[model samples]
Target: MEILWLSEEDVKGSLSMEGTMEAVEEAFREAGRGTVQMPPKSYLIYKKYDGDLRTMPAYLEEMDATGVKVVNVHPENPGSGLPTVMALVILNSPKTGAPIAVMGGTFLTNMRTGAAGAVAAKYLAKKSSKTVGIVGAGAQGRSQLLGLAEAFDIEAVKVADVSLDRCRALEEESRTFLDATFEISTDIKEVCDADILVTTTPSRKPLVKDDWINEGTHINAIGADAAGKEELDPAILRRAKVVVDDVVQATHSGEVNVPLAEGLIALEDIYATIGEVVAGKVPGRTNEDEITVFDSTGLAIQDVATASRVYRTAVEKGLGIRLPFL
Candidate 1:
């Protein structure tokens, strides 16, 4: 048996934003229809290093796809010239449980996550949305912009970050891929006021306030993927129509976790999952004046769906190294 090994560059080179969005959307639909089996991610915390490792696994029954992702998050890695997050994925055959591919998942993680945000925005955000606001101008922020640009005709982008350098860098980079005007600021209020807001920070406390957001605004809450992390004011959650990626995962670790834990909101308050909305079981935005939020906790099904695409593309293009493993 041969196992294919794909590097980070190989995955990025093979995947496109548009393709990834479509694949992730399909994955959401499958999940909504209860056709996929994805367990909640298991975590291993290292208090000393202030980081955590997560193991995510999923099986798409209809697609006959199965995969596991091992990922880590260390906020202090950047000072040592490393990324804050890194990941690896192993794709396997469902019938025999044989490993078919081992690939770098860091880039895949960013792309799929971005694709999720884009998919949420497609379903939740208004069709006339033109201005986008991004908080935390990191790699994920750039990926969010890339994915959103593919879905919407964004005319302007407002980026907010603690570090002006990061904000400026994101602004400069946006010029290459996005045909939009970019504004860099440290003011969270300015960022939250856009037609569409994307929160990508690892902030434990809420950076956006309830009053900063206007009616009809759509938010993609992408940063808070672990317990105790939240980016939006719980007050915002109370009034907005919240759509989560996965109910189990989102309640435990997504943007809604904090609010749900504090009793600020109830499970019943969440309107629907993005999958439910995508599957047409629930409506997205009913009116122009309704505020909407998509709480994405990054699903394992997304990993497998995206990895499957990368694997097929690699085979067609003769990429990656095929090594005999058995």
Candidate 2:
């Protein structure tokens, strides 16, 4: 048997915002319909290196897509000229449990996550939302903006970060695709004044205060993938309609994890899962004045779905190297 090997470039060449969003959206629907099997992520902490490795496995029954992603988060890797996060996804044939493809998952991770945010905003954010705010100007932040531009007719973009260089770089980079006027600031609250607010920082404490959020705002809480990491104040979650990618996962490591552990909120405070909303089991954004939040912990089903899409495309295009295995 030969396993197809797809590099990051191959994956990037095959992905588009629209295609990824479609794939990821369908995966969420499958999750809502209970047609997917995704175990909570398992972690291996490397305290000595200040990093952690996580394994995510999933099988989408209807789609017959199966994959596992091995990812790592090392915040200090930039100093060594490496990305802060890197991943690899291996797609397998659900029929016989044979590995079909192995592809670089870092870019897939960014794109799928951004697609998840866009899907959440599509259901939760108002249709008239024109302005977007991004709190962390990192890889995830850039991807989120890319997905948002595809989902909404964005008029203005506000970005806040510690480094002026990163902020301006995002603005300049966005000009190639995004026509919106870009504003860069170091003030996180200044970026909060928008129709849609996205917080992607890896902050242990709340960077966005409760009062900073206004009425009718839709927030995509993209950070806090692990325990003890939080970006929004617990109060923000308390009053808003909180939707999670996965309820049990969110309660353990998503944005609500810290708050739940501290007793600031309870599991009952969650409004609904994004999958349910997409599946039409629950309504999204009943009124214009209601605040909404999508707590995303990132799902393996997303990776599996997107990886399958790429693998199919690669095979059709005669791309990727097929190496003999066993």
TM-score of each: 0.99, 0.99
Worst lDDT 10-window in candidate 2: 311-320
TM-score, model 1 to reference: 0.99
- Alpha-carbon RMSD, each predicted model: 0.7, 0.6
Q: Best candidate, lDDT-wise?
A: 2
> What is the per-residue lDDT of model 1 for residues 119-195, given as tens digits with 9 covering 90 to 100?
99998899999999999999999999999999999999999999999999998887998888888898888888788
Across 207-308, the per-residue lDDT of candidate 2 in tens digits comes to: 999999999999999988999999998999999999999998998889999999999999999999999999999999999999999999999999999999
Backbone clashes per model, in order? 0, 0
Cα error, residue 67 of model 2, in Å, equals 1.1
Score candidate 1 by lDDT: 0.93
